[model samples]
Target: MAIIPFNKPYLTGKETAYICQAVESGKISGNGGFTKKCQAFFEKRYGFKKCLLTTSCTDALEMAAILCNIQPGDEVIVPSYTFVSSALAFIRQGAKIVFADSYFDNPNIDADKIEQLITSKTKVIVPVHYAGVACNMDKIMEIAGKYGLFVVEDAAQAIDSYYKERPLGSIGHFAAFSFHETKNVISGEGGMLVINDEQFINRAEIIWEKGTNRAEFFRGEVNKYGWVDTGSSFLPSEIVAAFLYAQLENLDEIQKKRKEIWNYYKCLISNTIENYQLPTIPYFATNNAHMFYLICPDLSFRTKLLQKFKDNEVLAVFHYLSLHKSSYYKDKHDGRELPNADKYSDCLVRLPLYYELSDKQVEYIVSLLNY
Candidate 1:
């Protein structure tokens, strides 16, 4: 039997060529020609008001935190089931993290419960679009509007996915996207910050350039650049941008193949598993097939299933131990019992669903699950 890893990064055959081009252009540092191309590609394709590539989605989230001007004592509401970056970004800016629970049917933040969590100190609402599935954005945005709060969408797994007719990253005041190897798009590691509010655009560029006005200086809009604000080295190098542009060029084809693989797994397991729940895309959301996960009835069953996969030389994995219950944050939590978040944290198991995973491999993995 062959060992099947949980994820294998895909390439479009143009990554090396683009990297060579970027190298020959003589500017390999952050924010060069290739970086502009990648930024322009997203801005044009997604209708994002402004897009800036970052070293990682975490960096993008951090940038959003700065743009929101999160201050000490300010509170940010985040779903407990999400990756730590969603909360850590604001937490770094001295914001209090108020973890919310997931909806019982899905791993998205319970939008209905958001209002009650809002206090006078609430500064922002961070929504993580798990597995590229959109949360109830309309409700989230409405809640944000009602309280004059900002929204930073943690769209790490939501590239090319949509909520209703709006693009996932375009709905929020600021959004962060990932190009990590495990995501639908791969650039080894990369990310982007989408600025939808025009008020933040000028400052965002300065922030991307390590708190300097160098971007304007480069464009001849200024004679010289100087440090104008507090920021850091957040932009990705041209090499990273070049690789991401290669992936962007083939986004449609990649999405199509990934969706096919995702559907095959769903079809195979829909009726075979007695006590497992598969991923669901609400009517208002479009699937980008970033991952295919199962919710086992309990942690013990999930553990057995994972061991079974390992015994068969296949790799399956779990995701996101609830951050509210994490050793670092548990004591800080306000004693709210987030049952649904903990439930998903213990029961969710992600199967192999990469661009290169073949139909035969999918069948074999499903066979192991059925056994």
Candidate 2:
């Protein structure tokens, strides 16, 4: 039996040609022509104030942390059911992470529970848009406004997703997006940091250029550039940008095909299976079809179901093991039992989803769900 992998990176066929063009043009470094084109695509399409390409989403989050100026003892509220980068970015800046619980019915942070978690030490609220579904941004933004807390959206899986007609990355004060191979869009490993607040725009450029003002000097806005801020080598090379631009050009077609695969999984699984909870898209959110996942009835059921997948030579997986309970953070946690976050940590199973998935493979995978 041929095994079905969890994810396969899709290529637009123009990636190599673009890379060749970038190399022939003689500037294949970060923030070059291809980078600008990629950045402009996001800015124009999503209405983001500014976009800076980074080597990875984790780097983007780190840049957001630098811009936030987090200090020791400062608290940043983050959902327990997200990637480590969401919390690690702030932790690296010496901010204590205050892990929040997810909604009982969904993987997104519980917006209603967030206000109660806020304290004088709270500096930011990091919302992770899990599986490309929008979090409750309206409520979240309202709470942030009331508390004067910054919101850095971890929109790693939320490319092209929207909340109430507003794009996900455009809602937060700062947002980070991923272009990992497994994502809807791919450059093998790439990401972007979005600056929505004008105050951080200048500082962001400096931070992006390794704490220097080189970008300004290049633009002739300054006579000379030197070390002026704090940053790291966060930008991806032009080769990655070139590959990403090719992917961006075909984003609509890619999204259309992925959404078709997502719908196929939903329709088949919903009809053939019972008791399992299908993915729920809130009325205010638009699905970007990043990955299709289902919540099994319980941890035991999920464990056994995964074994079944292995036995059948199909790849199935779980996501986010609740950072609050991890060994590194368990002792550091505030001892609050986040049942909902833990529930998702143990129960959510992502099925294979990619642009090139065929109807025959879909039927085979769906048939396995009958177990």
Candidate 3:
């Protein structure tokens, strides 16, 4: 049997053609024609106030941090179970990261428990929509409103997913998305920052253009552009944008196939898995089939299960480690036990998921789990 890798990047067949077109356009730098197309697509389709492409999701998050004007001693609430970029961005701004726990049933931040962690120093609440499933945004937003805190949605894995009919990235004052090869959409490495608040739109462009008024100069709104604020080279090259635009053109087709694979895996394993938990999609969230992961009962069991998959010539993998307990942040963490985050760090396993994964492959992977 052929080994099934954990993830395969999907190609929509127009990537090369688009790349050639971008080359022919004579400009491959950031914020070119292709970049604008990709940005406009998100803004028009999702009702986002503004969108800016970035070199990576990490860049987008960093831009958001700068826009928030995070200062030393400011507090930013982040889930302990998510990718490091989610917290690292705020930490870079000298904000004290207040790590929160995940829900018992889902690996998303527990919105109900967030208020207890809030303080006068709290400046932003970042809610990462894990596995494209929506967090309890309604409750999270309510808490932020009551406390006068900014909300930034870490929607890196949540394109095309929604909360109560509103798009995932649209709910927060700022949002970040990824188009890494492993994501449903493929750009090899890319991301976008969505500015939902009008106040941040103009400044976001300036920040995205490396702290200058270059964007305004290009638009004839300014005579000349110069260094005006704190920023970095966050935008991506036109080649990345072109590849992403091709993927966006076939978004519906890609989503339909991926969802079929997701449903098939769930149907195959849900009834048979006695000691493990499957992903849970809240009623308010629409599944974009970004990933399909399993939660084993404990570290030992998960380790054994991973060995089983490897023995059967199938590759499976675990997800993020608890950020609060990481080597860099363990001492800084307030020593609050994030049980749910720890549980997920040890137990969660992601199987193969992509547009190219076929029914036979899904069944074969499930067979290993059954044994």
Whole-model alpha-carbon lDDT for candidate 1: 0.94
**Mind giving the per-residue lDDT tens digits that candidate 2 earns over 220-338?**
99999999999888889999999999999999999999999999998888777896898989999999999899999999999999999999989999989999999899999999999
lDDT of 1 by residue, 49-163 (tens): 9999999999999999999999999999999999989999999999899999999989999999999999999999999999999999999999999999999999999999999
Residue 108, candidate 2: Cα error in Å is 0.4
Which 10 successive residues of model 2 have the least lDDT summed?
267-276
Q: Estimate each model's TM-score.
A: 0.99, 0.99, 0.99
Q: lDDT for each of the candidates?
A: 0.94, 0.94, 0.94
Candidate 3 per-residue lDDT over residues 248-351, each given as its tens digit: 99999999999999999999887776777989998889999999999988999899999999989888999999999999999999999999999999999999
List residue ranges in candidate 1 displaced over 4 A: none
Model 2 CA deviation exceeding 4 Å by range: none
The lDDT of model 2 is 0.94
Error of 3 at 185 (Å): 0.4
